[model samples]
Target: MMNNKISVREVLVEDAKALLQIIPIIDKETEFTLRGEGEFRLSLHEEESFIRNILAEPRSVMFVASCNDNIVGSLGFRGNNLTRYKHTGEFGMGILKQYWGQGIGTMLIEHLLSWSEAHDIRKINLKVVETNIRAIKLYERFGFEIEGVQKNEVKIADQYYNLLSMGKFI
Candidate 1:
């Protein structure tokens, strides 16, 4: 059954401790992600500082998904700072390996779309490893279209993979 109890909300500064523990785990769990296993080496204090800074940014938003009070996923948007690119935002997300295919990613994307539109973001962009068909399909379902592909953009364990650049105009 789907975990209807999963709760998603904007991340808070106080959530840093729990986030620090989970971020690296989630990063290592997904080969489709930019970071490979054990590459996320941020310390607790650094994570807290980063979280505080992100929370303070008016153009940025980060949300976490939790089930039974345990965090399982994260989605974030980083808006371009230059006035020329203010209307564009970049997205990044990851869910625990165990939670894959459970619809949590869809929930996060839906929330992101609603939030981005409300914030006056005109374009939302994301890069997906070409081999990650699941993620590509998910983005396509949410109206994101592939704009181009960067050949050999991602190298994992000495093997390179293309990266698909996608964007959604709201």
Candidate 2:
């Protein structure tokens, strides 16, 4: 349920091409959200490979927000593993330029939390840009607490930006 327009559903393997159309939108967000981060902007081929990888992983999931069957946004959750931390998960979500400021992101997070709980995942974590105050606030609303900070963690173009680690427990 989002803006009474968008619908969230499991991402399909064939959706790789459709998802590619949203690349420019994600790129713009990454410019700010992942600035000073040595992040790789995925090419179509690379993204397709990633889609395949996600599809193959049983403990990972991908969801997309669609309106009239057109992809508008996406979110993903992957189970974390470090032997002692097998009950944890990491999540990420993104909305298209036109869809930002809507309630989609929060709704997506809600869905993910519910999904995680049902799957027996006890904790969920996310790394956000320190400058992304709006996002940080939203996550707080959902009960995520600031766990710590990784200062100058991302080297974007020429600068290193700080990252805030946030987590929520079920």
lDDT of 2 by residue, 87-154 (tens): 88888777777777777787788778777777778889999888878889999999999999999987
Compute each candidate's TM-score over C-alphas: 0.95, 0.84
Candidate 1's residue-wise lDDT over 1-170, tens digit each? 45457888999878888887887888777788778878888888898888888888888899999887888899989988899999999999999888888888998988888888888889999999998999999999988999999999999888989999999999
The candidate that achieves the highest lDDT relative to the unseen native structure:
1
For candidate 1, what is the TM-score?
A: 0.95
C-alpha lDDT of candidate 1 relative to the true structure: 0.88
**How high a TM-score does candidate 2 get?**
0.84
Cα lDDT, all candidates = 0.88, 0.78
Error of 1 at 53 (Å): 1.1
RMSD to the true structure for each prediction, in A, is: 1.3, 3.1
